[model samples]
Target: MCEDEKSLLEKAKNGDVFAYESLIEGYQKKVFNLALRMVGNREDASELAQEVFIRVYKSLKGFKEQSQFSTWIYKITTNVCLDELRKRKNRNITSLDEEIKLEDSEIKRQIEDDKPTPEMIVEKNELKKVVSDAIKLLSDEHRTVIVMRDIQGFSYEEIARIINCPEGTVKSRLNRARLALKEILKGKAELLSYEFVK
Candidate 1:
C-alpha cells in the first residue's frame, strides 16, 4: 500500500463512505472477474462481488495491516466463491441451459484486427462457452488456483498468500489445473476447430 492508499484506508476506517468506495474502486473489477471465473455466471458473479465488498466493510476494522490490503480482500473473495461453489455442489445443481452473455469487456480477442464480423463474433462466443464449461468442470481447489494465477494474473507468491497455501502447492495445483483444462478442451475440439484453425 502506498501513502495515498494508507490515507484512504485511514479515512475509510474512520467512517468515510466515499473514501471507502474510492479505496475499493480499483479492485472491484478484479474481484468481480475472479468471482465470475469461479462461479461461471455474470449474475452470480455480480452478487458475489457485492457480498465480498460487504464482508470487507464489516471486517475492515479488524484488518491488521500484516499483509497487502489487496491480498486480504482477494482471500475473502476466494473464500466466498469457494463456499458458494460448495453449496452448489451439495445441492447437485449444474445449470448450463442458459446462454452465456458476451459483454464487450468480457470478450477477449485474439488478433485485434478489424472490427469483428458476425461470423467472428459467433465463433468467439462459442469459444468462450467451450472454455467456460471446461473451467466449471474443475474441482474447487484447481479452479481457484487457476483463476488467481492465470485469469487474475497473480504471481505464484501472491496466489499462495491469497489461498493460504505454500508456493509449491500453488504451482502443483496450477500444473494439474492446466492439464485438466487441456483434457476437457480436447473433448470439445469441434468447438475450437472452426474458431482456432485459421
Candidate 2:
C-alpha cells in the first residue's frame, strides 16, 4: 500500500467513513472482478463486493500491519467467496460450473489487442468464452488459484498469504490448475488457433 492509502487506512480505522471509502476506492474493481470470477455471475459478484467492503469496514480496527492491506482484504474476499460456495454446495441447488458466464466486455477487458477484423473478433470472443467456461469447470481450489494468479496477477507469495498456505502449496496448486485448464482447452480447436496454448 502507498503512504496515502496507509494514512487512509488509519483514518478509516478511526471511524472516518470518507477515509474508509477512499481507502477502498482503488480496490473495488479488483474485488468485484475476483468475486465475479469466483461466483460466475454479476449479481452475486455485486453482492459479494458489497459484503466484502462491509466486512472490511467492520474489521478495520483489528487490522495489524503484518501484511499489505491489500492482502488482508483479499483474504477476506476469498473467505467470503469460499463460504458462499459452501452454502451453494450444501443446498445442492446448482453446480458453479454452470453458473459462470463472462460477459463480452469483461473478456475484452482482459485482452489488450487493438481492433481486429470482424471475423477475428468473433473468433476471439469464442475463445474467451471457451476459456472462461473451462475455468468454471475447475474445482474451487483450482479455480481460486487460477483466478488469483493468472487473472488477477498476484505473485506466489501474495497468493500464499491470501489463501493462508505455504508458497510451495500455492505453486503446486497453480501447476495443477494450469494442467487442468490446458486439458480442457485442448478440446477446443478455436483456442488452439491462438498462440496462448502453445
Please name the candidate that would achieve the greatest TM-score relative to the true structure. 1
lDDT of each candidate versus the true structure = 0.79, 0.79
**Worst 10 contiguous positions by lDDT, candidate 2:** 103-112
lDDT by residue (1-198, candidate 1, tens digit) is 988988998898888989999999999999999999999999999999999998998888899887899999999999999999879866767532222223211111122235334355457676677577668766677789878888889999999999898999888878877776665565555544454457
lDDT of 2 by residue, 21-86 (tens): 989998999999999899888999999999999998999888888768899999999999988988
- The residue ranges of model 2 lying beyond 4 angstroms of the native Cα positions read 95-122, 188-198
Candidate 2 global Cα RMSD: 7.8
Q: Count the backbone clashes (under 3 Å) in each candidate.
A: 0, 0
- 71 Cα displacement, candidate 2 (Å): 0.3
Per-model TM-score on C-alpha atoms: 0.81, 0.80
